[model samples]
Target: ERHRDMRRASSSLLGLAPRLLSGPRLCSRPLPLLAFARASQQRSGDAALALGEIRVADATGSLGVMTPKQALALAAERKLHLVEVAPNASPPVWKLLATLPVVEKRPEPPKIEEM
Candidate 1:
């Protein structure tokens, strides 16, 4: 009786698996494509800067629209990184972010003492 119940449950789960796999996903893009897009973005800081013009903002509030060069200059002056917050906006939105540092840090090689 116990074995029969387990078999029934397993069969039901197997039947539901197909539906679950075919159902609408939370994200429109597939998992692998999403991962690839994220990886590409991380690999290049200029991904957002590639745009002609963007809406820049800071800690206080919006800084208005400006060229990528100008935004980058402003961010450099404040020791912050110019990061894209919204890519879908009309001009795309960029913000001066000091919190998230995107620079890569490489570890120093070990040194050996001479005899």
Candidate 2:
């Protein structure tokens, strides 16, 4: 019985695949390619911050439709800027951090015995 039900469900989903894969319905509707490109650039910029480099990132929320400037001011205090952390969020969130001034710890010099 369970196997029969599984097959039925799978077939139902398969039938809908073509419609789901088809392009958008509106011929004149502007695609979000430009927005996606900008977001990609923003993500690359965020990578620099993750590497401890100084940078400013202006984040967008709600499908990149709304931007709140207050976030930028907060980031500036830390010498950083808001950057998108996850683009998949319904309203993406950003973080502020220094990108250029990553302080890498140096290894201590090895001690040598006097000859």
Candidate 3:
């Protein structure tokens, strides 16, 4: 008898599952929670500028386990060193400067052909 009652209760619960999964029903319009979340997390001018250089680095294999010295060595030929931009991250990303090899001569600008 208890088993039968339990089955009935389970079936009733299952019936309500559809309505629960349907999400919030508000008239005919549904508010976008995702947009609200994004807007709330949006930063102001200063904060945005500060975070512009920040990046998340994912370390997976042996290469991900590179030491700071090794990273510096790898980046030596170029310009900027691999710095830990985000210490909180498992493996921080390194910012490479656009103007690398400062001592090296910059490429010459292309000359426009006159028609």
Candidate 4:
């Protein structure tokens, strides 16, 4: 029907295709895809250096707080990378990341039972 086609077109345009095809949704309607696309996305690696002042933390506990520049210098001295762990905090929290080697393990073949 013309009405159904129009509804589908409008829903798809508003990023509501999932709700239309799916039976029911637990959460409220999703925001438009464009809203997310336009928002600022999280950066990585050296980008943490631009986060101004940040709090440094580790497995042992909080390592105290410092400016990004100082923290980066310390991280370099320790042979680690400054990674933003929690960006929503007051000044955001950064962690020291150390590179580790990756190991791949393959599974052994199953044994065959003789008749």
Find the candidate with the highest TM-score and give its number.
1
Candidate 1 per-residue C-alpha lDDT over 1-106 given as tens digits, one digit per residue, 9 for 90 to 100: 9955764576587664433343345553212233223423532236656778889888899999988888877877899877666677889887787866444558
RMSD of each: 11.0, 16.3, 17.8, 9.3
Q: Which of the two candidates, 2 or 4, achieves a greater TM-score against the reference?
A: 4
Cα miss at 42, model 2 (Å)?
A: 2.9
Q: Scored by Cα lDDT, where does model 4 land?
A: 0.66
**What would the TM-scores of all predictions be?**
0.49, 0.31, 0.27, 0.47
Poorly placed runs, candidate 1 (over 4 Å):
1-45, 101-115
Residue-level lDDT of model 4, residues 1-115, one tens digit each, is 9956876777789777654444433464434333212214433357767677788976577888788788878878988766666778888887776852233467889999999
lDDT agreement with native, every candidate: 0.66, 0.45, 0.41, 0.66
TM-score of decoy 1: 0.49
- Candidate 2 residue lDDT tens string, 1-115: 9955764566578674433333353563322333332443455332433332232344342223333454444555556645555555545555554653223468999999899
Q: Candidate 2: lDDT of 51?
A: 37
**Candidate 1: deviation at residue 55, Å?**
0.2
lDDT of 2 at 49: 33
lDDT for 23 (candidate 4):
46
